[model samples]
Target: LFQKESHIPLPPKKDYDKVRAAIEDALDKDDYDDGSYGPVLVRLAWHASGSYDKASNTGGSNGATMRFDPERKFGANAGLEVARDLLEPIKKKFDWITYADLWTLAGAVAIEAMGGPTIPWRPGRSDKLENEGCPPDGRLPDGDKGAPHLRDIFYRMGFNDQEIVALSGAHALGRCHADRSGWINPWTNAPTTFSNAYFTELRDNKWTKKKWSGPPQYEDPTGTLMMLPTDMVLIWDKKFKPYVMKYAQDEESFFKDFAAAFSRLLELGVPFDEPGKPAPA
Candidate 1:
């Protein structure tokens, strides 16, 4: 129920903080398919926000339009309802926050819970009408594609080479589902923890093209771990490989850069802070 205020009043920022803490608590308790809720929460935020197009400004984290049937029905959004459902209690408790802000904050919470850096977040997004919902499918990157494809997809979202590498560090948390993306196995051994194992595995292990009937993906020589084609192309391609090697060589540096880039990814289109406000540390 909407409360009719005498005049437009700003919601307490503490309410957003409370919702964030509650979501963190929920993530701590949930041990889902990928071990922690961290991955799904990350995926939820990605799928929810990855729809942005700087050219048209049709979609972004702004509307939280994934709530509508048309947007929810997209194939890439499969299994994301699990994430939305997990955060429902938090939303109910913090009735003042919009679904857009709540979902992105849940991502920040998940990242922090998994031992990642704080994702600077701010509030002020509202849910849009269903008529303003639904982005065309395939906004998110495909695992089947190579570096060129990765560049094409993410560059369209306004990310550069460094940001793409940093954001893909999310592979450190979740596994590919055969049912969802036709890919399997977490890219790193400790899929739930927010370590730099993804870069480590990429550098240390020997990868071979997977010989399977599903989507095109790579396997480590031991044949246990997996890497998507797009992931491997980071090494195969000359342009992106340098950053990948840098992250692979230094864990601390990787974490620091990843935290900044991931936080920016979460804040993609939502305007927060004044024009001259200092950026998040």
Candidate 2:
């Protein structure tokens, strides 16, 4: 008898583009926050992948483990279910794609659709069968902490100070829901657009403690915008401050660095067969 060989064939890049299109179509609705689910989608992708530990290689985007109990219930991940649920119909429509791939792809598409830089993404991640794959609690960053906390959380994921600042630039896109993170307000007036406004606002504005009942957070003089302790520390720290200023001065630089850093962020711990091509717009 002849030996038999069998394997599952991967979807071609064009099929992945169709998935991308479905994600794009699902992004905008008048009823949603800021008229787009883009910000939450980006948050979903970041939180899903941010659990990586370079030393152990245990967490990150590979397993789509956030669907599990402990990880889903993590305080840092509050309100992200909105993002995950938004992607579910797309997941059902394209049943062949893994939840891991779909979540990350929605992030890249959200960024591009919201006037941000193009993030290179690919599809190869697989789902975990059980919650055993969940990373320990506290793997994600704490908004209430400062620079030291930022460094410890990000450094564990193999990122340096520069990359930390670059990744933090993502704050330009979303607002904090009081019910979710115990913080409230957006970092910029144009919260829906992805620009260097985060860095610019952080650089140019004078942030004072918001006189409110909420957790400790900073707000601009007008009390219209806000910043977390983690965000405020980027300007106060010597090492992180320079990049913050750099991105603030040059939109092109911010876009370039953000694209590279954010792209690498979503790919953490994912095993791919080969190099990935540029993601479709």
Most accurate candidate by TM-score? 2
For residues 1-281, what per-residue lDDT tens digits would candidate 1 score against the true structure?
A: 26566467885554565676788777754446755787899889888878877777667787898999878988788888889999998888877778998898888788888888777666666788898757787787777777887888788778999888878887888888878767888898888898878888887899998888888889998777999888898888888888888988887888888877776676667665553253332
List model 2 lDDT by residue over 19-124, tens digit each.
9899999988888777889999999999999999989987998889999988899999999999999899988888888999899989999999999999978777
User: Clashes in each model (backbone N, CA, C under 3 Å)?
Assistant: 0, 0
Residue 178 CA displacement from its true place in model 2, Å: 0.6
Which sections of candidate 2 miss by over 4 Å? 1-14, 275-281
Quote model 1's TM-score: 0.90
TM-score of 2: 0.93
| RMSD (Å) of each candidate, 1 decimal | 3.9, 3.8
Cand. 2 Cα-lDDT: 0.90
